[model samples]
Target: MAPNDFDNSIHDFDTTDDGSGPEPSPELWRHTPFTAFVAGEDTRAVYVRDHLPVLMPSFVVDFALRCTEFRSLPGHIARYAESQAWGSAEIEALRSWQRKLVRAGLFISRTELYTRAAAIRESNATPAKIGVIGFSTAGDRADLLLRALGSFAENVQTHGRAVDFLVADSAVDAGHRGRLRGLAGERAADLGVTLRYLGEQEKRLFATELIRRSQCRPEAVEFALFDPFGAGSAGGANRNALMLHEAGSVLAAVADDVLCELASTDSGDFKLALFSDTDPYDRWVFADRADALEAVSFEPRDYLAEQEKLLGRNLGDLLAGVPVNEVNVRKLGLTFLHLLDSGAARIRTTHLGHAGNPAIPTSSFYAPHKGTERELAAEAEIRYRASFASRGALARLATPSVGDGTVSPGMAIGLDHRELLPPFFPVLPAEDLVFGATMGACCPGALSGHLPLCLRHETNGDNAPLHPGEINRARQGSVFEFSQILRAIMAGHQPATQADTTARMQKLGRYICEFAAQPTLDFREALHRIVLTHESQKIMALEHALFTEIDAPEFWRRDIRDFLDHSRDRMQHEDFDIPYELKAGRTNEENRILMQKLIASYGRLLEDWPAIVAAAWDLRSEGKQFSASAKAD
Candidate 1:
């Protein structure tokens, strides 16, 4: 259709506004009839999936035609239309026509419009002086830009010298309106061009012009259907459906790019780290890997799911099958460690750890020379080293604790497990290969109160256990201890002496065996008892150590007394209860009895305190060291 024919039809649709001009209302630009029509639709699904496929070509054609009409309109007519007042009936008629067009599957939503406009703007071919005008003041400048660009694509495509404009009807305040007009006039003068403010009627003319122009060319609609963002596109489903379908491919490509980049940068020493969260014990291991990847890799997901099958499930389904007893938990933990050992060999890095930490045999299964301890430690060391050695690389296995049992192939720094280990295993090692610990109700980080601090951290002032607070304290303490051990190790240290190391190993073995012996129902209470006994023993030893090993300072005495007093208060409060409920066969009465015995034990320990301190002082002159002394030639 000729441009004049389109303009004539657009003028016919301007019947809504009365010829008598009125002052522009602030709300005039804010009220978009098309927006209201879209909002009133019953379902966006049909419009986005089905209707959009049929409407995009018409939309583009209409938009292009409107730009053409606006370009061709005389300056006087355009100014006259801008001044015309839009009456309520006229607004309603306009809204109805827009709504009908949308319902008939011939209208495009603002989102689609903006997406295309933005793509156009980003293209190098876009003109430098393209003008974008918005009628409403309610939306931000971005929204205005989208609307203007979408409405005048043809002008942007055809003219390289057209500047954008925004004649906001919401500039109702006379002073603001005056300032806007003045700015427009100054800009026009500067550019040696004319800037006319279009009214609601004039905007309607533009819309009608687009419709008339589009109706003349039926084939253009079909062409638009084939455009990716057009209504006629074959797979014009929902907005994101196409993108989602290609997500896997996109991810694969991204992964390939990352691997290529890594290989390019550090050719020989590049680490191909793999981790899995499917095995409960390796949750922290996986987390540590994640932390490492976050630092260097642009795409961490590439490494995250690499070993999903080895763990028998994806990370999302790791905890789906819960273990009912300590045996099952231990089995899972061992399995996780073994899997980690295997995965580490596949990677390029020569360092391998059980759970993202240095390879330390923490389980009692590898404690000292007690039966299979040495054998198992040797087998484990050989197994890990051979994996890397087969690939022409040497693997270094290191541990934070000496009690983990040393093998020739690995280094056992001989640190005390209690001093070096956290209460719960952390995903990342607090110290080089020492995983920090955390306390939670779940298996991976749960603190079974095997440690004295872990038990006390869970207890309240009344001796009743705090639900999560104590657990949180244990977790925090674990991290703190890990940091301390890490710092100590970095400063250069040796393992504990053989005698001290044996004693610690024996203690850990006993605790583990006793814990494993408890029935599921009695596990919690048993753990509590063990923790209490251990704490009492520690206090007794500390009393003796004060005189013999540590200097007896005033602050030390006060600190010891204060700690004992707090423990005594907690034990005395009968109302204090365990934070969690006992298992199916356990009872509160059984727990209560245990608490009574503990309280009595605490009382006895305090009564013997004076004698204990005196005995410790007597032994001070003996000057015996508990830990083995440094070896001298």
Candidate 2:
């Protein structure tokens, strides 16, 4: 029968007669012995009821000899069966007995039976420590581990030997009141073994055991764990190494298993490779303490000061030391500076900080304030904007005085607004410049390189909801028109005439509106593309920025190039090098169609140069007039 066809209630299966009778009422079954066992009461009765029929005659005799009540029950059943001539004819009678056991919840499910049998065979072949780590509040996982262990221990084929298990919980608190502990302890005791809990001192204890087992020195083990910041024990790297040094192998979550394996290797020598996720090419390898310290000491103080001088602002706080909260911001600023110096046209930005905000104090960056939401946000904005201006970029603070402003020819449009924009458009302030520069350098076609400049918006203050009409108007008025001008300059063979530029802009606006109206447009897919592009771009941008800031750029460049090549090789060796697949449940054909549309749009942006320049000039003139009018008022 199908799973759905089965009766929902256990009471539907009769225990008496030929195992076929009227289904019992749910209320009646609720009070049965099996139900009582399931409710955590009188488990021994259910256990005995299930196993008694399955036990061999000699085992039953021995058990009966010990217990007075069941002394003659096994004998009586055997005699009765023999008198009736037990054979194929008595198969229905035997099935009825099994059905009764099932109704009592004594018979195991087929899956559980096979699993237990398999575990028993494995344990008999090779005895080893079976470690189970459960996260705090994950009682279900803990229960599953305990049940599997119990099944293996109770199986007769396994010689009734319990497996050694270490139950570790990752929760740092001293709350040991979980019911899994009690359940595991009881089960372990029944199976003649003890349940062990590994606490905060587990690492040290395991390490000590490992040293004893392997007869190795404490300093022989090294850990290669994920630690973005060199915070030592706080980041768990130091602690992991210490544990593995004392213990031959450490038990950790699947994510941390790779780190643990670094220590478990038979060979004592291993190199630690630390690389920035933002820049795949930027890497450091620490063979010893000296290499690590040397890598850390490469300062960008002078480089940052040069940028600060350009913007007429203090950016020492951003480059002084890494703030815990704004780790990525410094890299972002450096990337933007490098791109600007590399002859990229006006870098676009969204929500770049205003000039009014105070520079973050050196002390504040090192020791952050732990306070209410308002205080934290205030501090974060300060650091965020300081980091942006660290590279000498101007802030396009959105105010009512300037209404949806214009971009200069070969310059980025600065949309410094408080309203939230569509997910596809680059919304992050100065970070967009970094992404744009990287994208421009790495991607094919002139359009991919410059498309980023058209979408940048420099926002300030909190995000507020924007009306769909307002969003549509902003996209149509400035961004679409600006993109057309860029496309004409980059891809158009001939100089753009006034008429050609005007025609292209009009067509682009219509396309934007039509695309927005489409029901099939996936906002999530657009967001995913933005993220992927950012990641890929950031890698190149970060490497370029690092090379520009560091002393002996040529030597460092060679090293970084070699490191990236090696890293790529490693990824390939590990089967981690996979080609990008179209996401958001899109077919290959759909992806191709979308790409063609984007390419066509980019083509439209490449029109006549003169027309594009003229259009920008007109917009700037209009913006100046608006600004003058606002000032006059």
Candidate 3:
């Protein structure tokens, strides 16, 4: 049966006022599990029904187990299969959007784009654009931007290259933006890397102005400042990366990932031949000492008090001139990043790497492997799932039939081109994947070159979500992870030109209208399956990324296994009964009612995507500092 054919209850929620016929009455809706999950979601805590483990089914084995046993799941698990299918409902609409890209002849060379645009590649050691995509709650992650800028200055000192740093914040916080800009100016000026800040409104105004100046009927632009997919989101933090791509430009998103530049070359003046590396790191063993120590929370100011809590021995000795083994340094790094006083930075933007506690509550469908060491290993897998997929994706870009896999405005990627690549919508956490995939689809061989350049940095483990030894069950769909399955599956059906892409989008709109109205539960169930499939494919992709395991240090290999083993005991503390006090929020009925409203809203958004993408692309295009932004009109 098609994925949509699964008989699911979460898909049955009514969007109508009467709640008549097959749809439940509003009064009856109050008691459903779907509503309870979303209405009651937050970063802190929620009760997990015993059978529905918090672990994501990212592995094929886990996903298979869930599908095999899905029919026998408890009512809450089955009902909650789609507490928020609305998110997927919106994302699924992008499939219809892809067919619109005209399958004109493919060009696997970046030079073709420059030739077609009548543009020349600017030769320079410095990147063309570097925008920092900072999405947070009231700019709580201002520190990350600060840290990234500091690194940029350091990078200049280290690599001896000029930088242009841009911060395009999606969160709605003006005062916060002002404060960051204030702190950034003097620091940014010294390097001569002009720093520009744009909040959502400013970005829109800039995009609108660009559109007005162009005088092209707004629909002609292929990029968006935000909401490229026409789904109701800025796409994700990676949207800025897409907007920054123009012709033969090399751009980067100043994110938390460490910069370990590797050797690269170019395919003539037009194509950039560089590598985008996602070098995975254990939170405790970061490549950089400062980041490593910060992860385990080493407070030198209050060293005496914090040491007894974590290392028992004074890390003062380690920080001092005292000598130590690599093992001790790793241990200190863990404590340095861990501060018992600070639990899960509460900033809630997720910054695209912090999972386990995503900013939004997503699908709760899970397999039966609740508390196994294998499940604990899965946490590490999901934490960096995109890196694996992105590594594997190089294969798609490197296909002999396809052009060199060169991505534009690539972050977590290094691109050689410096021209226009369409900006992506921040709808799903996988916006970066979308940005890369979309660029690849538009010009499969346009990439200057394909090389694996993984950046090594601490990931979710640095977020300090759990106590020293605790790894809680996590939500699969959230801020940091990409729906690689979505991108991977859609890869083959790529449209050639933006005009063809629009045509396909129109066809999808018609299908969505009918699909939403159909009594069949395919759309909701199909989306749900995609979520699981993403997890499954994620684990499978690790094979491509982990070929370097043979070179890992003995200590990292031995103790890392022990740490994961130790975490299993801590995670096995399962609880099905959430106390009334602990579960204080909307009642089940209230949550159900709210869910229906969201489902209906998402359905509408999905249907309206084509119009939304066209307008938003024109506007969102302004969010990046693309020199060609004016010409894009």
TM-score of each: 0.17, 0.18, 0.41
Candidate 3 error regions (>4 Å) = 1-138, 157-163, 210-238, 241-249, 256-411, 415-420, 448-485, 488-520, 529-633
Model 2 off-target regions past 4 Å? 1-435, 438-582, 606-610, 619-633
Candidate with top TM-score is: 3
Error of 2 at 331 (Å): 6.1
Q: Which 10 successive residues of model 3 have the least lDDT summed?
A: 343-352
Give one digit per residue, the lDDT tens place, for model 2 in 1-633.
122322232333322221112222111111111211232231222333223423222322222222211112223234445555667555344434433443444322322221221222111111112132111112234444455445333432244322343444332333332444566667667766544544334434543444444443333211111112111112222222222221222121111110100001111121111011122111111222232223222221221111112121112211223222211111121222222222222111111121111111111111111111112233353333233232212122111110001211112112110111111111111212222322233221111101100111112333322211223322211111112222222222322222232343344434443433334446324423443343344346536644554533343334335433433333333212111222234554454454334333323222121232232234333441111000000
Q: Looking at candidate 2, what is the lDDT of residue 370? A: 18
Each candidate: RMSD to true structure?
A: 39.4, 35.5, 22.7
lDDT of each: 0.24, 0.26, 0.31
Least accurate 10 contiguous residues by lDDT in model 1? 450-459
Sorted by lDDT (best first), the order is 3, 2, 1
> What is candidate 1's lDDT per residue for 1-633, written digit by digit as tens?
233433243333333322112221110000111211222223221232233422322322232223211111222223333444645564343333333443443332222222221222112221111122222221122233233323332333334434333332222244544444454445444544433432223323432332243332322221111222111112111101111111111111010001111101112221111111111111111112233233222221211122111111121122223211101111112112222211111110011112112222121111111111112233354332222122111112111100010111111111111111111111111212221111010012111110000000000112221111123332111101222222222123222222232233233323333444456457545545444554455456445644553433343344344444444444444322332222123355664444333222222222232222233223323542121111110
Candidate 3 structure quality by residue, lDDT tens digits, 58-152:
22112122221112122222333344343555435422221111111100111121122222122232322332222221244556565656654
